[model samples]
Target: MSGQRWDMGKDTLSTLAKKTGGNTQDLGGLVKRLAAAAQPLEGKLQGAGHDAFIAFKGRVDSIANDLNAGLAAIAKGQSGMDAATRTGESDMAQAAKKAEGAANFDGAKFTKR
Candidate 1:
């Protein structure tokens, strides 16, 4: 009878020890479930980031294109203005030469003398 009681005590203690010892498979399963639960949120965040990146890239491209076009317009305007100024200067120089030729050597024909 004492032997049977001793065996029962040993069995109870062994069962308790085995229960307290953590199982690797259970822990792994729990980790997998937690990861699975977070997958949707991760995917959503990725999608949002991708959308924002595309929008930002498009905006930057648009701004760059507009800036280039504006610069080209400014260059064309400056070129036109430079051509006009050159033409005006040439005309003024020709008029001055003609006036100088019309004047006499002593500057008395057209002047008061």
Candidate 2:
């Protein structure tokens, strides 16, 4: 059983080395190559992140513009409402004065000279 285990371990190591295309001692070289390959990807990721930030900023600006437009519309509507209310109040006051004048004329006619 021990001999079989030893043979199995050796076979496993050799198979692993063959599959990896190199010996285990070449791990450092493989890591360096992998790092070299990853550097360009890292730069690309940074550029993508920058682009995403710009897009996000553009969206924020658009939202801010929309909010400003909404506020301006609200202000205009409020001014219109205020003007209408003032006009209505003026009309009511004029009507009250006319009614008062009519009442005074009626009272004067009912009284003696």
lDDT, model 2: 0.54
Q: After superposition, how far is residue 76 of candidate 1 from its true place, in Å?
A: 0.3
Those runs of model 2 whose alpha carbons end farther than 4 Å from true positions after fitting are 1-55, 104-113
Task: Estimate the TM-score of every prediction.
Answer: 0.45, 0.44
Residue-level lDDT of model 1, residues 12-88, one tens digit each, is 44343343333323444444455456546553565777666545444654554555555455555655655666677
- C-alpha lDDT of residue 62 in model 2: 52
Instruction: Output the TM-score of candidate 2.
Output: 0.44
Best by lDDT: 1
